[model samples]
Target: MRKTEGLLKLLSLCLLAGVLVAGVLFPVVGAAGVASNQASETVDSMSSELATDPPPLVTNVTDSAGNVIATLYKQYRIPTAANQINDAMKWALISTEDRRFYDHKGVDWKGTIRAAISNQTGGDTQGASTLTQQYVKNYLINVVNRENPLGQEKAQEQTIARKLKEARIAIQLETKMPKDQILAGYLNVVEFSHQIYGVGAAAKAYFNTTPDKLTVPQAALLAGMVNNPIMYDPWRKPDNAMHRRNLVIDRMVDNKKLAPADAERLKTEPLGVVEKAPDKPASNCVGAGPENGFFCQYVVDYLLQHGMSEDELFTGGYTIKTTMDQRANDEAKKSAEAQVKKNQPNVANTLSLVKPGKERHEVVALAANRDYGLDKDRGQTTYPLPSGVTNVTGAGSSFKIFTAAAALKQGVAGINSTIQVPNFHISQVFTGGGDQCPPKDRYTRTYCVSNATEGGSGAMSLQTALATSPNTAFVILEEQAGMGPVVEMASKLGLRNSMAGNAATGGPVDPDNENAQFRTSQTAWYGPSDNSPGKGSFTLGVSPVSGLEMANVAATIMSGGVWCPPTPIASITDRDGKPVPYKEPACEQVVDEGLANSLAVGMSKDDMPGGTSHAAAAAARWTRPMIGKTGTTQNNGSAAFVGATPQLAGAAMVFRPDSPNGGLYDRGPGNVVAARGTNGDMFGGKTPARTWFGAVSKILEGQPELPLPPLDPRYDRVGRR
Candidate 1:
């Protein structure tokens, strides 16, 4: 007996050694021995044990007041805990998918053996996958898709090798998570239709209800869809869906999860599916609210440009709070729409409001008159047209504020300084190397400039010239200050020269290229173009700038020369509600308070009686001090009004793209009539100014009245006369 026992022990040791050798030789192969080479590779790459990581959830975007403006989702999913899900749905899924789910480890070997026998006996193919196995499969699929996009298709194939790998992962997942947690994850990651994934989304899509609110019939119907969602979609095949739902109800009754009477009653009920999939959940800003769509798009574009990847944006559940005040945004939109309706239907209008903050420049409102869509004829462009950090349009005369600021800063002129103004011509004053004229007049040593009104030229103070918006006065001022200083000053004030130049090209320009040179001379009026170096016209507002930029310019003055690059985002929080790192607003004192105050006085004069924007001032009916500039581009191609108060600043612009030379005046007869409106001719002080007033008045309705700072004593006497 002792000899026999020793021999058995020796045999057992040899067998154990042989098993160890096999494990060492084939480490990737699972114990099931059915895993494919690809599955072996996948298992070898993963941890020894797998853990459940929930899929991505929807991100929420809120306005300044913390009201949800939009919900951005990659899969339109809203995750719910296992307890939060409807009880009926949970039971139904278990009954139909895995009756022995609660009793199994992970693989349900008895069911697998039964399925194998049935298949061997010529019976229909059966699925023996436990709920845990299904969860593991879905999780692995997501992991593969995210980590190895090229191998995703092969990873999803329904082969014995894939099944064995799924079983191994399922056992590991079960060891790491509770049964209820596994069930919840499975429900959350399973696809119900093409873009519809997760039980929460499925409930909403099928019945327009939340997961916890699903009724017995609805629960059963959805539970039945897990096997073959497309084949049993109630929306596509009601009859097939009804049959599947009945089977699930029957299984629930058999498993004693539902009373036979209750099951019978549920079976009798009709599938109350929604008429249409709940307006296929929008994947991006294209589906944002009509009022918030453009702003949302702007936010999206901003994030993408700032190094946030598309995958991260879609998957990361970021909580974004923007600087937009919904009230201001609404008012701006209304004002823009009203102006568009009044003018030619095709003409575009944009209104933007900005305000100063301690840490950043706030974009309170960004509004346009068109819908945010892909239909070109219906005005689909995300208008106000973002240039770089802000939007862009022809600055026209609105740009004179920059030139005026530059002159004051350089001490080349003051609000009281006298400058010769020409009634409609100043070709003789700007005769120099950079003062080259159009090719037709190349040989002429003249660069004639004009005022919007005839017989309005003469000796005028810089303040009066600003209030009147005389093109010749500013051109002469630009020459005196030198284009270099003017351009440099504008740059310091957040006017990206390259972006401004690109705005003149009439096509989309790369906002990312800081060194991109301005290419077209026609739009050069929008900005100083390298191609057209004689920027004597720079002071005349020839460069294009967005309404937001103009508003920022005004905001800079309001902030006493502190230029804070405008930012829409107020705060960003990650999934755990922790602040994410982002670039802080770069605030710089670009101009002296004295110079800014002097310019403010000039703009304030424009809104006073006899000033060019007097009509707008009247319309605004402001009770507090306000300063503004009115701008009408050459040939009336565009009209703009930029204004600032102690508390707020805004800009409005109207463009006539189809008009002759893109002039607002040459817009169709309807536009001409709407813009003229018994005012004789459309000017910057008319439509654009009025639009700004109409919107801003509403925005400032309840705000406390604040007065602008007193002008610097040195220049107080210059423009007052």
Candidate 2:
């Protein structure tokens, strides 16, 4: 009976040894066999193991039509399975992190035993940690083991404890997870330094490609960096990194993972690190360098803070379908910059907010006096010149846009209501004794037939006042419409971000108070103001208004009252490219269609025989029928054109608000620059109009003709039909 029992024990020992050998030799099928045995034994019944699924990945934004617009990701975690990883990387990981990886059970017993022996002797604390344990540490524990010098790790003694804990976890994980899940966890856990957290990031950071696109040698180099991020950093020490990579190749050959010849050939090849930083998530959209650098930076910063995540914001695979056409913005930026350069040659050197570096130019223009006045040459200087004290220039005639719309909204004016403009002026009282007149009224309130007379004042039709931008005519209309109604109209036109809200409501905005610097300045009602010296300009447009706000204003009239805020990013998708829900623009009609049509009446006048913008108005002008208004401010000589087509409506502005040497700047108020020259004048009529024309031309490309409103039947009664 004793002999028979001994024979059974011997047979069991032999079977166990055979199983171990099989597990070591065939890791793939062996894992399956282990799982099968566990299932048969009902091991899962005792272990309460839970599998973790990753959050839905937001890879990029798409347009309304489902085109990619941006890429988004969280935790910066990218999964790199064995299939997605390079063979070289696999070998490197096995050789350095776990040489006996396949040969072990859920735990590397031999390595643990060896490490235990070494720790007992106080030999340089080498670890016996498996890839599974490292993954747990990185993805689950989130602890940084910074004890050892050779790599980022704890002592062998501590490592053994961690490995034991990991062994228990791995067993539990295997019971609950599929092989792919385990591999994905491993891929996401591995980190390569230099802000790279996974194989995917490493692939992009080093080679400017994705994991699947990586070559064997490239993969090996990346894998080598896992053990010692700094020592194997490709950018910092290419030689050391390459040497480590070669060691990985050598290990692959010794393990029979690669042919000797293949390993040798790979070692001889040069490391192909990309010359430039891989195109990161956010691209430098403006490639023309520091010219217009401030404006570009402002836009980029805004997008970063409010647009999307770093992943979704900068990834190259996604397309950003911005509300503002990139092409149009770029051209506008270029034209404005070129014009600035032509007009003010030496002014480029003035805007210096930062320390000078390679190709870093900080140039901004400024005004000559603290109060509203004509601009003069200030010449360029280094370091960003302090911004001028910007006072709010009263909206002047532009405010009439609000008044006219309000009158219509309140049933106070008809489209053809022929009201007369008389000698008139509006007054606003300050806390101090004196009363101030609007900047436009500062010169005179005159309704003349031509520009030949200044003191002339007369009664002109409302249509004529609107066509010529008469100030008194709008003031009278404002009284009938009431300030409240006009303010409401401006607000609905998407004109927010102003102190005028409070100022027009008779509130005070103290510019002298540093704590209230960002507060809306009273000048916002008219335009940007030098509210305080040593501070930047405030107000809309050439003052403080965003380009998008201007676009919305035009959109409102063109929509016959509908307003759609500009949308830059469209849709978000997962790593696998599945859609994620997002908030779209809230489309609403903020004005009456008929009222909007009345405003368009005056804009359409600009396209008629004697219209202001008639030079560019022709039968073949815009692909769609259109109407628009041109505004110029004398302060900065900035000119603006707000135009709308039935299909598309937009606006454009040109100004050098931060000029140091005011000479060569806009000659009149900022708004008038567009009307200065015919070819490329400083006035809104010429250069600014041209900019509008160019942008409209591009946006209209390949688009069908826009629908138009039915002809007014008033002509039937007039007999002109």
Candidate 3:
């Protein structure tokens, strides 16, 4: 029976060779007909396209000083070169997957013929694909057609067409590349387990090590997983994985790639895999950890907003260099948390820092009391608290700076220009833009403004008004400057984000809806564009605002009146270090240089004895040539402080970040401390200003004290530009 079987196999091989010769020598005698033409065309087209693009690599993000902080990628792969991988990795893979890999051109025709015959005769289906063929197939599915469902299916479908395509591509690949190079490429592209690809990521994921440190057993286990990573995952199915790994080890020994004694010893060893992969580079901003994550998130958002798509950023393998200063971020986080504990609920203390430059304003750091994470229980929140407007309730008289800027721009007021300050007054030019006026109240149906503290009565210079933060004084100045310029000035200075919506209320910023004033859309609460007389209270600062915008506002002022869009990116480059284009920074001289310099000096006394933030600055023993402003909303609900010097600019705010209507004193279920100062009040000069000094003072520690632009005397009084 055995002799007859051997004769039959030999006769079958001869018959197959005869059919192939007849088809090639005499095409018209072929039985395949059009299928032969289609098969030939498929081979030709598939072989034409070789390895065009390399596989995806990890995209790294670094800080301003070039310290890698985070990594973004789709496949979580660490592409290793041929020489970077351990010899055991390549040898184990080739020995187990294709023993004749070194000798064969691309495919083993003998094994292919035997496997095809047995498969056609109802024997078990066998895969006679060589290492080069497997590499071609994996490259097709994972690299070329990774995002194409139909193309991926075509590459993976179990059919003769797929096999032929792989064989053709593999043959072409062999002609262009060496065997070792093909082996390295194959190991770099194939999947080892869920979200784990390449021998580099696999070694780190499975054993908490690198490819260069992989042992014989470690390499064998990873090599075995490429056949079916999901099925042989050591964590999910240790027994099946053990059996598969043992097969690779045994095959290596059979091929003399490993010693018999070593194979036996390795087989007896336990499957050593880490309980879970430390996904350091796999997570997006989450991997950045704690305070650094917020800056990472900002960089991601900034890139998306400018032009880069999410897919391109995560998978394009580009290097992102951000302007985030790690030291500044750390100091800001420490200070903000000291003022408002990270565990403090419903209230958030935030600080934003920007470096002022005549041509560009770079955002250096953003920090908040809340952590940047998903754990709500651990007082973690992902809200861009330090840079956004969503958590702002109001900034009170802090906006007096914009109103003052408008007045200076229009030549209607100067640093020493005196304005009447009344303890309380009903504006003749403005009307109440909300329902705050009670029906029977004395100030009913009118725009009422008052100073938060007494003795703000009588006449005061615009400079003194700024330091004391008297609402009535700014109201009077806003009326003199007219509503239009004051509103536009806020937008130009940096409150543009707030000028798009009404403050404290969700009412849309409707310039046409004159009736919006009756609903908090105008009067003291309207956005910057609402130039109606009803918005005369714009100088009183009742508007939604962004901390980042406010910080840049201070930067704009410090930059000698040049307004530049704050950017978080230092630079971006492709994997090969080619420069990537981004939106060019734009800076405008919105204010006259002389007028802005004088204005900075005018507002410089906010930390003086009579100033609002004097107590806070004095407590820190702060003595620096800086300008600052303090503001508190009505009823002490929320407040903000903005301050800056020639070297650094920053904004700090303490507000109710949880509930829309929740007041600073109204504690929430998660509250450990209410948003209040030691004086039992929510004031910008208190906790908020302290938050600024706590952070900014340290952030500016070693910087040289450059004097602010010399004040032009012409603008000290009511001198026009």
What's the TM-score of every candidate structure?
0.85, 0.67, 0.88
| Candidate 3 residue pairs in clash (backbone atoms < 3 Å) | 433-517, 503-544, 523-534
Q: Write the per-residue lDDT of candidate 1 for residues 1-721, one digit (tens) a residue.
A: 9999878866765554444333323433454574467856665444233353457777787899988787787767777888889788899999999888888877786676556445544588887878888876666555436456656655567565566566666665666778887888889878786567788888887788888898888988889988888998887888999999999999989999888998888888988987855545577776666677777876776677667777777887888898889988889888777656523444666777888643567888887766665666655655434223222236578778877877887677788788778765544435432343443354645566766678864888888888888887788778777666777776666664334356434444565655333432223333344544444666666555666777888888888888987778888898879998765447888888777877887777887787888876687685568888888766566678888888788887776543324344344323433432552234678777877888888888888888777778666544432
Q: Say which prediction, candidate 2 or candidate 3, comes out ahead on TM-score.
A: 3
lDDT of 3 by residue, 1-721 (tens): 9999888977876776554333322223323553466765655455445454578777888999999888888878877878888878888898888999999988786787677677756798888889999888888888778789899899888776567557656776787788888888888889877777788888887888888889999899999999999899898889999999999999999888899998999999988988754343645887787788888888887888778888788878888899999999999998888777788657788899999999899999999888988899998988878877754466777889988988887788888888888998777677764454434346546677767778755998989988988888888888878776776777777765555554444335565664443222222434334433546665666556788888998998898889998888889998789999986547999788887798799889999999999998998888888999998776566778999999889998877777755755563323325333443436788878988898888878877877777778778878544
Tell me how many residue pairs clash in candidate 2. Answer: 79
Clashes of each: 14, 79, 3
Candidate 2's TM-score: 0.67
lDDT of 3 at 30: 28
For this target, which candidate reaches the highest TM-score against the unseen true structure?
3
Could you give the candidate ranking by TM-score, starting with the highest? 3, 1, 2
For model 1, state the Cα shift of residue 379 in Å: 4.5
After superposition, which runs of candidate 3 have C-alpha atoms over 4 Å from their true positions? 1-50, 278-280, 433-444, 501-531, 663-681
lDDT of 2: 0.48
